[model samples]
Target: MKNVFIFTVIGLLFLSCKPEEKRTDYIINGDASGVYNGVRAYLKEKDRTGRERIVDTAVVVNEKFTFTGKVDIPKPSVISINSVNGNLNFMLENSVIDISIDKANISQSQVSGSASQTDFDAYNQGYAKLKKESVDLQNELRNIHRQLSSGSSEQLQSKKDSLTDLFTAIRQKEQDYPLNFTRTNTDSYYSLVIIEREINKKNANIKDYQEAFNNLNSELQSSAAGLYIKANLTTLMVAFEAKSRVDIGKIAPNFEAPTPEGKTVSLNDIKGKVTIIDFWAAWCGPCRRENPNVVNIYNKYHSQGLEIIGVSLDGTRSQKDPKQAWVNAIEQDKLSWTQVSNLSYFLDPVAQLYNIQAIPAVFILDAEGKIAAKNLRGNALEAKVKELLAL
Candidate 1:
């Protein structure tokens, strides 16, 4: 009985002493020849606010540095070393990684240990080919455009045809590559990563992004990349809707904001007339110069059922108050129109609704509030107004 009890107690002690299973932790150790001895390394992951969250930091020790952390799953993080030698942006996954960074040949640096990194290597190799071809085609198109002014009529037509083909091929390939890859690799989490990266391109179409997103695996849809896509996808949809509204033959999206006199004015207030939706900011020198042209057009066309609705992008700043500036500019420029603003600058809700990319933008709306034209400046603005009024 004594031996039996002793054995039982020993077994219990052994059981209690056993180490728990190790969590998913990563150790990134690497050497860079050109880095300063005490240079800091920042490990970062992007957050929803379009900013990076510093996961950790390590200082170079004895020409080597190490970082240790636990990752619930694979994450796309960057090891950024900003030093006197230059900046090194090394992309890595959250796994035990051995980095071999060549300062002189940084692009050719080798990173091993993570399966996802291996996949990244392969993806970039293929992507490089397509990007190279796209760049070459773009260069050729630019050179062709430079010759447009002096080209013979037939030559110009031929150049135009070539330019169209090259441009179309480039866009189609960029769009199709992600769509085809995501559709073929539905279960691949990295597929969502690639789509997330590509969908942020300025030329990305909403339909393509949606199709690719839907094709992703359900598990991937719950991943970090998927969440990033979901957030940006919402922004893209808003921009897409706004873009469509400003296109010719589409009705304008109505908005209401406060005028300089604290009176609220809405786009619908100026309906039943040919109205110009002018997007301008008080700080824009060109916008101030262009104000006279707009004034002239309004004066000449105001009698013929022409109306103007100016949307000022001006907002207050710490150094200067934009409301006073906006009011001053209006009075000085003699802009006699129904103007409104929320004073939020680019973040102005109305500007975002119309997808206003730059100042001095205008959408000429017809009598029924459908966009008849856009970006009609100087004589073009006057001519379009005249033509619309005649109709």
Candidate 2:
């Protein structure tokens, strides 16, 4: 009876001590016939913002390689030789994934074994076909132009017009295909993957992003990709509509930033006067060169209700301190106008709000704080200031 009791205690301890292997363990096996033996392989993953993490490494042995690791959830992974020679990418789901490469062609290589990876490959194959057609149309158009330029131009114009239209249609389809997929596949985690490529593009589209974001399932919407979009989509929308934001007829977007003395100052702080919101950087050569011209205008117009707010994009990198750089620039340039900076350089809140892409950017506001003119430099800037103050 005592031995039975001891055995029961031992059974409980054995169960408790056993490690979890199924939930965490993932096995990757690959055969690359053309890739030389003993080549190093890197397994990299990204954490939401698309920053790479080299989780593990392996070496090819006898034309084969394997990686065994554990992960809590599926992650986006790039299996590459060294760091930059990317082999292929797949959703590193918790499964025994197999890769087969033939004759140095990574593109034609077959990746199998994980259900999520199967879905990824199928979707990617269809997407690749669509992209190829887009490229083919472009190449055909370019070829036609070359033939026309070198030979007789008869019947070429009509062909060119039709080809141009076809190219435009194909381009639009290529851009919209992934967006449509995201909208339809609410359950798949890769749906977020498709939408993220669109969202992170230069001057991202607001309407499409909003629609795709709404279509995401609750599970995906709370994931890292969704959280990143939630944090940044508004900022992108504002930046994308910068032309409208900077147009002369719109009310200037109000921005608050710290002054040279560490006190917060905003557009509203000096609202009753004509203001020139000058975007400049201490490190900007053009801004430095143009400072004398700006200084002259400020001296001439300051008494006449012309107020200049110098927005400095400086002190963002770890190598330099923003406060000291701003003060030094102001003193060196003999800038008498009020200056402010968040010290985040280009990503400064005000800079992002105004969609200030270029340095030496200027926005002149009228007495009521409405945008008067934009990006007017030197004589144009002085002329506008004089004209507005005269009003």
Candidate 3:
């Protein structure tokens, strides 16, 4: 009898000690009463495959119309609650999340655990500083203008010189202030050991910024405010990479692909001029919208040795006919540039090499093979073409 009791106790302890497997579940708890509708609750997981899995369910609540559901969610789960009311955003951890919406006029709001006071405070401070600086600068400029208007010719010139000096001083101070803030914030976020490791690993080479960027946490990586703190780190990295890979006053990276005319064209064939390689796709809305601008650039500078090579990434998986769509868009938009695509679409080797994340991406190569500038769109693109081609 003694042995039996001891064995039973041992068995119970063993069972209790067993680790519980992670689970996925639906849990909704919040005020469902009032005019709340268009509230969506679901389980979204980024599995081993790196694909998102969304599981939807109806929320269950109490007499007050509160919604709750118990779901066995896996560890490190991401929960998305979408409400049309005030556009609520929230996140949950472990089990049992409860939400109470006091706002009625909006569809969905106050998804619990999503708001970050730290982020809000940081962004607010940064924006406020920016606004104050702008106002101060404007006021200063107006005062200078008023002084110039009231002065004689020689007095006005002296005042103008003084104003220019003041402007230069202000600009320098502005630049210095941001750099100081970024450096200080960087130290707070990254350890001295980590930063030294980063700097040494890159050997001060700017191109290695991307590696450091990739090392950032996913949340920090996704946040623009976070990136801003990094000090335009991506741009710096790209600039370094370009410097190392491509030489100034040399022919740029040239390749060939089939144009809509079933003819092959290479960058060398378009040599002896500045060229704009536009990386875009039929499915990209921004690229479509910017097409008009590109067309205008081509027309304005085509005669002045400015050539364009549009590389489309709209792979065969898209709904539209790739060839016809490219052709039709070109003809309709009057895009008189050399257009080509390898048909690999997003998986295009060139895009991967360049680390392009969004559409309407462009790189302008001068008469030499070097990348003169990147993402030159709108007035910027036009200004660059005119300046480089002396148009």
lDDT by candidate, in order shown = 0.79, 0.80, 0.60
Instruction: Report how far off residue 333 is in candidate 2 (Å).
Output: 14
lDDT of 2 by residue, 30-84 (tens): 8867677778877889766787888888888887888898865556687777422
Where is model 2 more than 4 Å wrong at Cα?
A: 1-24, 32-42, 46-53, 57-65, 81-86, 151-154, 232-244, 247-359, 363-391
1 or 3: which has the higher lDDT? Answer: 1
Return the top candidate by TM-score: 2
* The candidate that achieves the highest lDDT relative to the unseen native structure: 2
Q: TM-scores of all models?
A: 0.56, 0.58, 0.42
Q: Candidate 1 on 1-391: residue-level lDDT in tens?
A: 9999999999999999999764467888777766778887777776534477788888987667788877655656666665633333344555678987666765576788876676667666767888888888788877777777666577777877887797788777865776677777777666766677766777677767777788777777877667768788888877777787677898898999999999998999886478999999888889999999999988887887889989998974751888999999899999998989999998999999888889889999888889999988999888888888875
Those runs of model 1 whose alpha carbons end farther than 4 Å from true positions after fitting are 1-23, 26-69, 77-91, 94-104, 110-113, 135-164, 175-184, 192-211, 228-244, 247-249, 254-273, 278-292, 302-361, 375-377, 387-391
- TM-score, predicted candidate 2 vs. hidden true structure: 0.58
Q: Which ten residues in a row have the lowest lDDT in candidate 3?
A: 187-196
Query: How far is 376's C-alpha from truth in model 1 (Å)?
Result: 4.6
